[model samples]
Target: MSDFNSKHEKVAAKLRNEITGTEYEPGDQLPSEKRLCDYFKVSRVTVRHALQTLENERLIYRKQGLGAFVADTTLNSGLVQLTDFSEDMKKAGLKSSSGLISLDKVEPIKEVNEILQLRPDMKLIRIDRIRFANGNPVAFDITWLPPGYGQLLFDEDLTTQTIYDVLEDKYEIPIQGGSYRITAKNADDYIAKHLGIAPESAVLEIDRCSRTTGNKKVYFQKRYYNPSHVSYVLELSRNDNESMSSKDGLPLKEFSPSFAK
Candidate 1:
């Protein structure tokens, strides 16, 4: 058993090297399991184990009928980092643009008001936008901010500039950190229209609350990503002091889908 494990690990290491070293580019199909077994002089089971390892690492994805292909890392973002949409697109070698849907001061729903911690009489500035990457719609975003910070955005060109950029550079309001809640949602008519996907298609939704200096909440945003255009990556270290039971672990709850009217 030990010898078999070692053999599979060796095979996986070699394939990982090739994939990372540019021998196999993104979206390139890998050799079949039989071919890999013949090349590595290993059993089919060993080859399968190696392929599974790569798939777990998100380095490759396998089709039901077709063989495994390298994953496009450009579409992946690290979950641990807090980056602006435009910044992320730029890093992926794509031009970022936004189509403003609406920007107005509105009465907040109970949930939005509670999340933003607004006063009773305070109206929220809401900004709705469709984010694009290389001219392709990738995400639909709705942002809610207190009147103070949000009104300032009214004067800026949201199509080309990110709220993060404006807040940090123009207003000198450094974004300290944020909390995120991620879930899988099915696109409704409104989301489908903005993202150019069929209604009922699966999408990745993230709810984020950002803060500024002195731990003051800045803004709350809901971003829905087209699964075909975006993927999230999270790296974990076993040596970290934060244990899964204490830091990373949260009580599991049933998911309920909500659709737009």
Candidate 2:
């Protein structure tokens, strides 16, 4: 049993190397099972097993009658690691800062009251800013926090710090987890004006409600990202127990931009 697993693993590793190391470019088909079998001196079953492993990793896709082809894994970014904008820029070796747009106490902006479970009279501290990387605008952030938690936004220098950082580090309100949804949206006039794109252009909207260590819901935001500057990605696994309630199954690519060219 061990040897059987080991045989396919060797084949899977070599194929993975080729797929990722520029040997097989995106959309390029792999050699046929018979060809792979002859090359590796392995059986057809072993080659199929190897191919299955790559399919699971999203490195390749198989067509029923055609063959396996490399998946285009470029221009996509992962949301697997939940990090504040500052840490995200640090990872990419770029300087990150915020340009404040507006900050003030306000009547609950759309859905802010429900997301935070606030009372009808409780005002929300709305902080609006354009997030920058190396001084280039990448995303527009509109965040709402209850007064007790949102106070950090005023305490810290947002020009050099992030709300998430201040909340977790200073206020000790580490975001333990969050619920998020991603959807493609046409850049509304408000979003386009801030992002400096044409009205009705394409944008990625990431809406999230985050909770603290005590499972207290306190943070809510509408983050509009320029897809050309940032793309949202999530790595999924069949083995993962987490499943979205579905009428049928799951999906992401609902619509693609129709380029007029």
Candidate 3:
């Protein structure tokens, strides 16, 4: 059993190297369990454990009975500074890519005007994208930018990169901070089709309005996340007077008095 553990670790190490080195690029399927077992001279259970470790690391992904595949590298920008989907996925160890769904200059609709704090007659550049992690669609993002930002995107490839990175590196827009709103919603038909989920499935909806130190609105976006594939985590403080809840918000535990207090 000890030997088995070591072999599993070895297999996992090699697989990690392959993934990080891009030996297995995003969207590439990994070898089968049987094949890996043969190569590593390990038992089926050992191979499975190795694969599970990789999955936990978010370096690879498994579909029900479909076999394992290299996880699409993504930037985990949420853990760091504010970033665009394209850039965040890249940092999160998934290959970030995007396809422009649409781009148009339109008068601020009521919702857009409210979100951006714009006048009803304000014209904004709206860009919509279907963002992919390892070539699998995972998010639908719609961004509204004020026109004064000056030719915000140089090319549609901006979808494959982080918007904040682009703005900072290419355009020199520095992000200081912003406000965010997160909620849950049933996936609409469009979201279901793009994310390969059932219609009416629960999904995470994030709306953000970000700005630079200069008080210029850098971007306002609404992102739809596939609930099964991602979850939002909040690190909150719990005073003695507060409470804890299950992920679904059912009450769980009441905070107790502090030891020193």
Candidate 4:
């Protein structure tokens, strides 16, 4: 590589480490470009290149005429992977936790009942929680599970453990796959309260149905994510014959047809 390229990359590497580490937290503004140039003994162009690299990685975002600020470093998930909240936070180098809102056995809504293939009289275990990343509220989740799987959670601590972990590890019920429907919605009063955002703020909503062996549904959950703290990346290939699939075990056939939208 040329000396110029090497210098810019070195600058970017240093900044990347600092942003990912405790040195710089989310929303922290980076040093001015002029200051960075002076400190690194590089030209303005080199510093700009470094900043551009970090921006492309989603580690930082630059404001026109203002400066670059660290991006929220939580819950950035690649759509191809099937990971829980804890796993996503870990991958982003953020601490993950949950605050249990309510856990109860109740009659589920009609939609949920149908999704779980339960009779009208059957009650489901409902778990409501606010998920946190580095102690910041990131998502409000409402999960409904069938009686058998739901009973397992009563003994486990929801604050420190995810339902996915509990079912897969303790009960040995592997979550084989899931179907997801993603959308954007304005936060209602209840969702806003739990997510600690303004009422009517935009949020990313995900309706997910996870299944175990033999395609038996395990849980149906609605997750409302704080947009500022979460982002999703979808990777696609150009080959027409290539089958598109989600690493998160989501079946593409479950996705809504283009004309249906």
Stretches of model 1 off by over 4 angstroms after superposition? 1-79, 240-261
Model 4, range 1-261, lDDT digits (tens) per residue? 446657878999999998998998888999999999999999877787677667656688889899999987563422243557887787777888999999999986888989999887789999999998889898999999999889999978999989987876565565656878899999999999999999999999999999876789999999998878777654433323234344434322111211100
Write one digit per residue (lDDT tens) for candidate 2, span 1-261: 245456777999999998999798899999988899999998776677678667756688899888999987762312243557776677667788888888888886546787788886788998889988777788898889999888767756787767765764454444646777788889888888888899999888888788764568878988888887875444433322244344323333322221110
Residue-by-residue lDDT tens digits, candidate 1, 1-261: 245557877999999999999798899999999999999999876677678667756688999889999987654312334567876776677888999999999996778878878776678999999998888898999999998899899988999888987876566565656888999999999999999999999999999999875677889999999878887754433423333345444322222222211
lDDT for each candidate structure: 0.80, 0.74, 0.69, 0.80
What residue runs in model 2 are displaced by over 4 Å at the alpha carbon?
1-79, 238-261
- Taking all chains together, each candidate's TM-score versus the true structure is 0.62, 0.59, 0.56, 0.62
User: Which ranges in model 4 have alpha carbons more than 4 Å from their true place?
Assistant: 1-79, 240-261
User: lDDT tens string, model 3, 1-261?
Assistant: 235446767899999998999587887999999999999887776677677667756688888788999876552211223445654565567777787777778677788776666778888888788877788777888788877652577463666555665665455455556767889999889778877889999888888898864576777888888765566544433333223233324322221111110
Name every residue pair that clashes in candidate 4.
80-247, 81-248, 82-248
Report model 2's TM-score to 2 decimal places: 0.59
Better model by TM-score: candidate 1 vs candidate 3: 1
lDDT of 2: 0.74
Q: What is the C-alpha RMSD of each candidate to the true structure, in Å?
A: 17.7, 15.0, 18.1, 17.8
Steric overlap count per candidate: 0, 0, 18, 3
